[model samples]
Target: MWQIAVVLFGVANAVQVDFRPYDHSAELLFNGSDFNHDHIFSRQELEQEFQKYDADGDGRVSRHEYTTYVTTSVPELHDFAHALYDDYDVSGDHHLDHHDYDMYYAKLDADSDGSVTRQEFVDYWVKLFQATEHLHGHGHSGHG
Candidate 1:
């Protein structure tokens, strides 16, 4: 079900003039998160990226902060920003903290090997976007 949304989201975005395919978005995220260029996303690197979303220097990330960052950094994801935020906010507290981060990281780390590979990261995000699209009822035009 979620996978359907992720793919639909990608297709929908592909139709827009400013559309950025889910794979591209995932690639950017993976590359950007790999600060050390090690081809692997370490927990530290992930946390660093998280901090970028933690605007205002607060220890936690509010829904607004996350949505702003996503829409600003990856406009194609704007429609699914809230869904993404809610997903990360596992505790349903309207904010993302260390616990949420840990859960998210675990989810991204599909192999449970403590680090995220480019493939793992990209696949996860693409699927997530597709799922969000389905959940949000973002109709796919199949035009692009």
Candidate 2:
């Protein structure tokens, strides 16, 4: 009887485990950026979205501005903002401008297409978060 109970407990634990990665921040970002409610994220929409992070109307997003915006707007992602900012700051100039946005957009587009679908956006961000979490040995518990 004890062995049977132990087996049932193991099955319950297995059922509770989810290996799939989900990033709530990515979902929020996709919803916010899909301004036209068209399900697809176009480059124009992305450019407009990126502008919000500039904060100072400087046509560029500094590390401080980016961090502050993420912390305040997407608090759940605040922990990974630095990593995301670093990834987007391709030029290593500590500021994100059109060049960086363009490059990042291209990356998110995934298929060299001009637009990004919700799946592509979420998948990329989830992978990024997973990589960051692995590096830091911590997990983000935010759920969408």
Best by TM-score: 1
Give a tens-digit lDDT track for model 2, residues 67-143: 88766633434545788788888889999988888888888988887889999998887787567764322442342
- Worst lDDT run of 10 residues, candidate 1, spans 1-10
TM-score of each: 0.72, 0.70
The lDDT values for all models are 0.71, 0.67
lDDT tens readout by residue for model 1, 78-98: 556787788778789998888
Clashes of each: 7, 0
Off by over 4 Å in 2: 1-25, 73-79, 134-144
Model 1 steric clash pairs: 5-130, 5-131, 5-134, 6-129, 6-130, 6-131, 7-130
Residue pairs with backbone atoms closer than 3 Å in model 2 (clashes): none
| lDDT leader | 1
